[model samples]
Target: MAPVAGRPRPGDPLDPDAAISVRGLVKRYGDFVAVDGLDLDIRRGEIFALLGPNGAGKTTTVEICEGYRSRDAGEVRVLGEDPADGARAWKARLGIVLQSGSGDSQLTVRELVTAQASYYADPRDVDEVLALVGLTEKAGLRGRTLSGGQRRRLDVALGIVGRPTLLFLDEPTTGFDPEARRQFWSLIRSLRDLGTTMLLTTHYLDEAEALADRVGVIARGKLVEVAVPSALGGRETAPATVTWTEDGARRTEATATPTAFVADLATRFDGEIPDLAVARPTLEDVYLQMIGDDR
Candidate 1:
């Protein structure tokens, strides 16, 4: 059995420039390995999404970085401090918005945000934080009375009230309706614009695509790949599928040069190609293929 907390290995120094860094990370529970020799780096002021199927090491890895769980062996740093040894000042620089909303039903939104702000040395204005999360209108409402989406917004408000330089958001928009999800995306982008480095974990591929500057996929306790949303697993250069209606029947073909294929189809039809569509692999497509290969 691996020990819960171990010293950082020699030559594994904390990187001042990185928002979060890990090297040869290992974590185990009883006899089962949860994280195995994983390496990751998240740059400053970027939104990085860690994606994987259930039971993958995504949560374990995040927990380790957040200092909520101890690692068996590794060098893990968040905001240039070893998480296992992070002091109160270091912890103040990080914010975590969990998957579930806060369970403090008695506190009003304003009171909760105000109380949380008191913990930080230089916290954001309480009213400003509420406005940032679109909760100003419901400031006096008790936590239990808010709708699901509103509750999630309050979670974000609490997370950002400290003005943390780094934020961890796990499944932030899980229960939001379509419009609410889009609104949440805008809010995240606004935070990114303010230079907040973010680590996001979500099962929603579309959410990852919309928010992540880069995405890393984990499988079976290992990282499969990491790339920008457009290029993850070579999605940007994947073969395109060209489709059209021909003689009242649908026809399709995969080709490397979709523009050339469409030009040829235009010539063959003497003008317009009927019901034409050209598509390349989406982020979801590449992600599924990556996970499939890992299995």
Candidate 2:
């Protein structure tokens, strides 16, 4: 498949503004190829979401970028340095939040963040980090006593306390309730405002649409497409589905020009259309179509 439009083609010069860059990345387990010639570029200060179903090699690709796994072939760069050779200083520039929180700890929120902060040469203020994650009120509470949402917040606190320029979030809002998930999304946007570049991996299509500046879908170990949520797979141009109540029964029509269709419908109704709803293909719809068969 062709690389997504606007992405760096293979052998192109490294983008100085990119926080993460991959070219012809490949990884194998025995004879099975997990990641095959994947190429991706995440620009600085943008939230880039990597999405794929289970067994799609997204996890392995992320691990390779994180320096926790080796690649069989290809060039991978995080923060302008090869992750395989990243030193203490290079590692210090990164923050990672896994799908699950570190198990309940004996330390209070403040103490846990304080300890995490000490590892960096210049970390964010301990109190500031806690407040940023909305855990300040729970600072005195031990980790084991916090609720699920609070624990997730604490995870983010620890991740950001190091003042990392680049952060990796894996299913950050997994298991969160609706309200809590929205709260977490707000926090992610705030981080972006602070100019922190993020690479997020999640199964939540809505979350990716809400938070990411751009999203990439991986399937069969290859990057199928990369685009802003609005334009992915040409979602913007996909036909719209218009549904309404007509003749006492529900009627549906697919149209390329919803606005014109609705205008005619209004004239037919002489003023107002009954129970009207016009919707174009959603991000989820486009995503599913892009990953079809591969799933």
Q: Write model 2 residue lDDT over 97-139, tens digit each, in one string.
A: 8776777899999999999998999999998888888898999
Off by over 4 Å in 1: 1-14, 293-295
Q: Write the per-residue lDDT of candidate 1 for residues 1-295, one digit (tens) a residue.
A: 1121122243565556779988888999999899987877788888999999887899899989989899999788888889999799998999989876667688999999999999999999999888888998999999988999999999999999999999999888888899999989999999999999999999999999989988889887887787888888778888999999999999999999999989888988967889999998888888888888555
- Ten residues in a row with the worst lDDT in model 2? 1-10
Residue 234, candidate 2: alpha-carbon lDDT: 91
Looking at model 1, residue 243 earns an lDDT score of 92
In order, what lDDT does every prediction score?
0.87, 0.89
lDDT score of model 1?
0.87
Candidate 2's TM-score: 0.94
